[model samples]
Target: MGIVVNQSIKNTFITFVGFAIGAMNTLFMYTHFLGEDYYGLTAFLLSSANIMMPLMAFGIQNTLVRFYAEHQTEEEKSRFLNLMLVLPLLLVVPIFIGLALFYNETAELLSQENPIIFDYVWMIPVIGLFMGYFEIFYAWVKVHLKSVFGNFVKEVLLRIFISIFLLAVHLNWLTSIQFVYSLVFIYFAMMLVMAFVAFKVRKPEFHLQFPKDKKEVLLYSAFIIFSSGIAVLLLDIDKFMIGQYIPIKEAAYYSVAIFIALTISVPMRAMHQITHPITTDLMARKKHEELNQLYKKTAITLQVVGGFIMLGILTNIHQVYALLPEKYSGGISVVFLISFSKFFDLMLGNNNSIIFNSKYYRTVLLLGLCLVVVTVGLNMVFIPSFGIEGAAIATLISIGLYSIAKLMFVVFKMKLFPFTRKTIISLLLIALTFVVFYFWNFPFHPIMNILLKSVLLAVWYWFLNYRLAISEDINAVVKKGLKFNTPR
Candidate 1:
């Protein structure tokens, strides 16, 4: 628990800094440097690659984390790690070759609405391969309890490179289409540096060692590939769909809404990097009680913090959007829908990392596969009618369903739920607080309105916990900040 919290705190700091840079790059700079269609294309192309990237890697990264932790001998772990790295190359090479065989048509279809896509589609799988291998190599370091570097590389370094790339584009060193291609290369470079840093810390010997029983590796790796592919596809399929069915500009607009919506998931992202390896180790030890406690506390903490952020975004979204150009204004509702979906997701805590690392993981992933299919179908049906907003609705429905399903699975299968009477109370307070602010309709400047609303919201949410003597964690934080427990 201590390690998870400590890592999460560090990751939280890193994510916030990156998020600020990302917001500037996406909302302000992208708009200033590029037009609506080109900016939209910028977002759409990357989203498209993200959706397909998982397939290219075939889920071995996650498999590496799960299996690498199980091995006892250095020889055994090294052998498995070597196989994991090589296996993805074998899987992706064939895929790239196959895609290349039909390159002209694939490019044409991918860029059907936007001619720029035909030129840039080739870069998608290349980015995916680097990202995929990066995760696998990163997992090697993570299982060793050195995740700060990987998180920094991912959340911080990636953004830093993209910012520089955008600045280059802004200065007229690269055209729009060429700038998009450079993104793929930049991600590759980041991963190359990430792999180097991870190896420096790990210093694992470079030798290709495979287990005596190769079938076992193949089976586990194959299952994870399908499972991980479906999960990534579910999260990212809409960007490709928007580009395929609608226009690139609309895909771009929808991407902005998703960026806003996904901010609520930052804590979860921070937590997941720390939590997954811990969960695997704990599961190995059969430490059910500690795991349950960690799970429950994490759920509550994420809900409480994520709920606050969700509300903050909701309450001030109108003002926030006012700062952006008019093309992005329509995405306000998209942001709201996406925020609720992520809020529901946050409410479930670290249910995802738990399920992913568990023994019965395949069943859960099978359920996830069904979800991707249903989500993609929903987007197909809804996008033509409602455009990107429809895509948001599809995401909302799918994420809501997926969160509920996973929650139910854990509750029924594990006989555990991350809920208490305090959870119920906190939710009631959140609802009541929203209604109060919704009606207040304050007469003030935009900045003042935000300040007043934030104060009231924070008070409403925290007052009950303080009055009821719950939230020992909150009390501890306050005391630590005040140095209230000095040895006098």
Candidate 2:
């Protein structure tokens, strides 16, 4: 727990910095520099690539984390690493060949609704390939218990480079079209850098043979592709389909709102980088009691942190949207719906890490496939009727239900539950804060208003949690920060 808290704090800081830069790029620069059409196109292209990444990476990123600790000897671990590295090519090569073979058809299908997508369609696979390998190498380093550097590269470096590219476009040093193509090069460059960093961390002694549990390894990887693929699809499909059913620019509107909502998940994302390997190790050791405790601690801490973020966003949503262009203001509802959905997700804590690494992952995969079908079907029915808001509604429904199912499974099958009395208390505090602050604001600029309200909310919320002892982990951190010599 000490290591988890320490690394999570570092990761949270890094993610916050990265998201701040990204917010600048997404809200102001992308909206101002590139028109909605091109901005939406950028969102569409990246969402398409992300949708394909899990498949191209062949779930090996997850497979490595789950199995890496099982091998006792350095020789066995090296052989396992070699196998993990190469397995993705078996799937990626065939997909690339197919893409090349049917490039025109693929472009045509994507551009059927918006011909603007035609020119950039081919970049999807190119970017997806690089994105996939980036995850693979990032996970490789994670299994070595070194995730902070990789998190910096993924969360910070890429966004910094993208900001530079956007600035290049603004300066007319390159046209938007050239900037688009430059993204492909940027992602591939990051992939190569991560690969180098990972190898340097623990130089793999490459081997061709597999461990004795070869069948188990292969089966787990195969099933994980479906499970992890479903998860990515759940996150990105709404954006992808928004482009297909409506004007591509609607995706831009949705993207802005989604980015605002996704801020709530940053803590979970930060914590998960370190907690995932720990969850896998605990699960393998059958430390069910310890795992359950960790699960509850993470859930409450994330909810406490994520819930406050949601309050901040929801309370200042009107001001936040006022800072955006008129065309993006309609996405205010999109922000609320998706913010709640993300908060729900954050409350699940390391539930995903547990499920993905458990023996019941295959069962979860089956359930997830069913939900994916429901998500797509709902999006299809809803988008034509409700537009961008409809997509948000569909996502809310699907994700809400899917999270429930996962929570129930973890409880019934594993006898683990993340919610505690403090969970309810935290929810009440978030609600009370939102009600108190939603109608209150200063006669100030939008940015300053947001800053002031966020600070007030943070001080109040953290004080209540600390005073009430809603989470021992959070309170302990507070005590340490305040230099209190308290008994454990």
Clashing pairs in 2: none
TM-score of each: 0.89, 0.90
Q: How well does candidate 2 score on lDDT at residue 283? A: 91
* Least accurate 10 contiguous residues by lDDT in model 2: 1-10
For residues 383-456, what per-residue lDDT tens digits would candidate 2 score against the true structure? 98999999999999999999999999999998999999989888898889889999999999999999999999
Assess each prediction's global lDDT (C-alpha) against the native.
Answer: 0.79, 0.89
Report how far residue 178 has shifted in candidate 1, in Å.
3.0
How well does candidate 2 score on lDDT at residue 174? Answer: 80
Candidate number of the best lDDT = 2
lDDT of 1 at 424: 82
lDDT of 1 by residue, 1-488 (tens): 67766877787788888898888787777776777787777777676667666666667776776677778888877777677767777768787898889999889877766776787777778877778877877787878777777888887888888888778878999877677778878888877887897678666655755877567767877887787677778888888888888878887678777888888998787777677768778778988898898788878777777877887788878766766788888999999999999988998877887886676678888889899889989999999999988999999999998889999988999866888877887787667767777556466776687788888878876766567644556666766866866766
lDDT of 1 at 35: 70
